[model samples]
Target: MTAGMPAEKSMNFGPSARRLLARLSPQRGQVLAVAALAVLSVACTVIGPKILGRATDVIFTGLLGKQFPAGMTHDQAVAAVRASGNANVADMLARMDVVPGRGIDFTALRNVLLVVLALYVVASLLMWLQGYLLNGVVQATILRLRADVEDKLNRLPLPYFDGQPRGELLSRVTNDIDNISQTLSQTLSQLLTSLLSVIGVLTMMFVISPLLAVVALVAIPLSVLVTRLIAKRSQRQFVAQWTHTGALNGQIEEAYTGHELVKVFGRQQEVQAAFAAKNEELFRASFGAQFVSGIIMPSMMFIGNLSYVAIAVVGGLRVASGAMSLGDVQAFIQYSRQFTQPLTQVASMANLLQSGVASAERVFAVLDAAEQSPEPARPARVTDRHGRVEFEHVSFRYQPDKPLIEDLSLVADPGHTVAIVGPTGAGKTTLVNLVMRFYELDAGRITLDGVDITTMRRDELRGEIGMVLQDTWLFGGTIRDNIAYGNPNATEEQILAAARATFVDRFVRSLPDGYDTVIDEEGSNVSAGERQLITIARAFLADPSLLILDEATSSVDTRTEVLLQRAMAALREDRTSFVIAHRLSTIRDADLILVMEQGRIVEQGTHQELLAAGGAYARLYHAQFSAAAVDLDEAAAAGAGQVPAGVGPRAGGPRPRIPAS
Candidate 1:
């Protein structure tokens, strides 16, 4: 399986190809119409050479039948069929045309030429019509394909994204889709035209002269053999090329998006080196595939020219024996060339189709990814007005083999603040993810207001909870638009009130454009604290019954934090809230405090009670206080220019001091 391939590996080339064709179901009528036009185009083109051959025969007969000044016709005028072991039947036959010019039939020859030209013009028009219709069908199919991909993205589980790079997925959506479009527009039409051309040319060759047709037919197997050999080798390279291109895309997205981190870590050279290596691999693979496929046209052309020469030699002998006409030999040579033309075209298209298939495989892989299991039949529906949440013996893991949360249980009472305090990697965010149904529980169940959450729709459960994470997300839009995202129908008054509550209005009013100031995609125009404030304002506007604050205030300054705390306190008046914080001071006044270590709750109680118990919470609280005191003392000592014993600027650092503050 390729990197980023979906778990459903059973969907092979046949199935993926079938799935792609299925997209054309709605446009079947249009497809048939285009095909009919293509066939007509081929028919007209095939008959043109035969009609031109008739004109050649007319002119040849005219020259031969005309009486010369010697009173002998052109045929009787040439006494010898061969001279000096040289085969120039045409030269020998035309030797008596000195005075036959007056008897030549220009009127009949003109009529045949006009018919040939008319057929060619009609063929060209039909081809253009076919292309115009096929283009519409191709675009319609692409539109549906895009819609399917977007729908698939919405249905896929969050863990699927967690394991795949955004750039790779983006490539599947943009690059892969574009590949399919190009293939449909260019390759498919060419394929149909080429196949029809080959068939039509073959029939014409045999009609003109079977002996020469045999020579022309020989080029088919040779062309096919060459195409097969090159396609086998180039197919693998094309697949690799697309895969590497996707990988390069991923690397570029990561490096450029996190350019600040790269600069800060001084890894500019490393990023460039990594990109260069990936790009080099892509280039080599792309060049190999293209070079191999490129040999087809020239190789087929050589075989085509050889066939033409063989036909001319054989047909000249037959014509001298009175078994063939000059026009027939001429048509046979033309047919031989036309026959190999489509063969070479099909060979080239074969290579192009291989690249398209590789892209299609990646696209199908995403569409085939395991989606979140279907919502249960007759799923229970419940409202979380009471805001009571419970986890009953819940166990979960991102990877099934490596358990993260095991047999954990907890309950948050209605209208109470439950502060979950844990060290990093203690599964703080996982708890929130479980409640949001972002990841389904491996064992046991969670409930909202005494109803099993699993029985309810995931959207329903998530709708009741508002979340503000440590990393704030804001799209490229005005401040008012960002806040209104959570509540699109929010009135101007409601929008202003939410912004005011989170102190977002303070900064917004200062800006020249105020609420209408547009931010970029990364929201780089604003400070981190300001972005966090905007997210908070968004949540406030949502007014979800249950609120989750996962280090929501970590980015703000002390003054902003104080204001945010006051704002949250007001919002939490009659709602159930879960606050996950590293700063114990932020959640010190919670109605319930759950001290966690690893993935289990080691201690739970009111803040003062836990402190009196001198457990993990008490130790954590004292450590923070001691760190604050040491910082203050160190600043004062620096001003006084004196070192405290075993504490300030010592070779060994002092242990965290437990001040009485």
Candidate 2:
């Protein structure tokens, strides 16, 4: 139904199918070659039984020549055969022993057997070639499909990823792609060969005896009906199974990613219970779909066997009635088996085909999703070094009706630090998102150096700005690599200098591998403060004209914070910077302090000026010290053995309290 969602109803095996086929257009020549080989393979196999039947007739005629019938002379038997008017039997009799029961025609039998053997060998070789070529074609098509999906992922907007589960999206790119590969590599060729066999066998059967052909074909409708009914019921279960599996994958990803938090909160049992519930749902749906689809093979086999028995019975009757030769009747039975065989095979594969198509539909849905609007045909480049930014009456909302930032306006002049402080939901991070153009505004514009950012190429616009987010992100790499991430081409000297500037060098030299040590994902092996330092170092290496530090010093200790402040002061001396921090003391000396509330700036001024005004910023600044004072009083009261009226024993001078048994 949507990107990152499991396929719902079975895809229309129509235009979407054609579109998938169109993807294979580049390999059309190879496809045609495989088809030609399949045709030859089917032809040889279909002709083999007919030739074998002739050999059987040859043996029968040899036996009959030795012993005609009870009292029948050779002449009478020949007359009877002539009246039957079968060319193959006549031809076989001509080569057999002339005298009655003289001897067997071993030489002729050997010749016929050789031809049959050669036919089979060639057919087998052709089949092998068909598979070999088809594999190449299928893989090439898959390669293109995978590339297209990867390109689509890069082109999609951030909101697309924000709404979809990473695990579900991964399933489409990996699991779904693999499904389509399996189907094309194996099922597609098999389906073609089976259909050809069915057509060729039917033609041969009719030529042998129209009545027997009719009897053999009775299973077609019956098998189709059974398979169709079961497939209809099973399709929904298949969809449900895939959907639950995706959900389960998402749950596993979240649980594992937040495993530390789960342990801290003692939620192991809760997480296990949730996983078990999702797993059970997946199992139920998978079992139902598999079990129901599994019924097709046996049901088709039963119907096929019924048809086989009828053809044998009726064909034997015709042979006895002199309406057909022994060879024709024998070939007819073989053809009857061949006809029902593909029917049974196709019936059994009904669910597999359905599933493959569903996977293709899911893959196609992602490819077809609306991509981010293209860059302007003639894009402007932001090359100004002034770092002047202005948000001009910009309005934005995650949802349309509930506006987060309505007609918001702000300006950051060159060579100044703008420290933004606000409550959690007061649109603080949104400002960074807007500046980077991660999302487009609903109305109005944002400008850099008085040039509208929307007109500039995204890469050119972002090149002038650098960010060190509150969440320090260091991918799996050596410390040197992480520090040089913002400037991949940075020299060893530059990297070391940035590290020293951020006070990161203090810890780097103490590590076992120094700058060469590899960190685990998310820098989990390092302390939070160390990771923050590395990110700060990375940003410093970039040395952009505009810097955004969103709570960059939040995780560091006071000593590290003081060092960072010194480094930042020097870095921000002649560069425009935006700093969002909760600790008022961190941004007390900023050139400008903007206090926000509910997406609106309630106060904007220097720290001293705001404190003098005694507005929102002043109250917030005083509140922090007041809360600290309250904590100190409680601690002092406990040390004095003076229990406050509502205080517990532990808060009353560390008194001995009864431990819970």
Tens digit per residue, CA lDDT, model 1, 615-637: 99888888888986777776566
lDDT of 2 at 81: 69
Give the worst 10-residue stretch by lDDT in candidate 2.
652-661
Candidate 2: tens digits of C-alpha lDDT, residues 1-661: 1432345565475666677778888988999999999999999999998999888877877777775555565666666666788655544444443456444578888998999999999999999999999999999999999999999998898888888887777877888789888877768788899999999999888877888888887788888899989988887777666667667778888899889999999999999999999888888988988899999999988898899889878877666655777888888888877887888788877777766766687788789988887888888776657888888888889998787888888899988999999888999889878888889889989988888888888888888788988888888889999999989999999999999999899999999999999998778889999999999999999988789999989999998898888888888765789999999999988999998888888899999999999999988888887896775676667557775566665443544342322
Model 2: per-residue Cα lDDT at residue 523: 88
Q: Estimate each model's TM-score.
A: 0.90, 0.91
lDDT of each: 0.83, 0.83
lDDT score of residue 298 within candidate 1: 83
Cα-lDDT of candidate 2: 0.83
Per-candidate alpha-carbon RMSD to the true structure: 4.4, 4.5
Query: Model 2: runs farther than 4 Å from truth?
Result: 1-16, 68-74, 78-99, 632-661
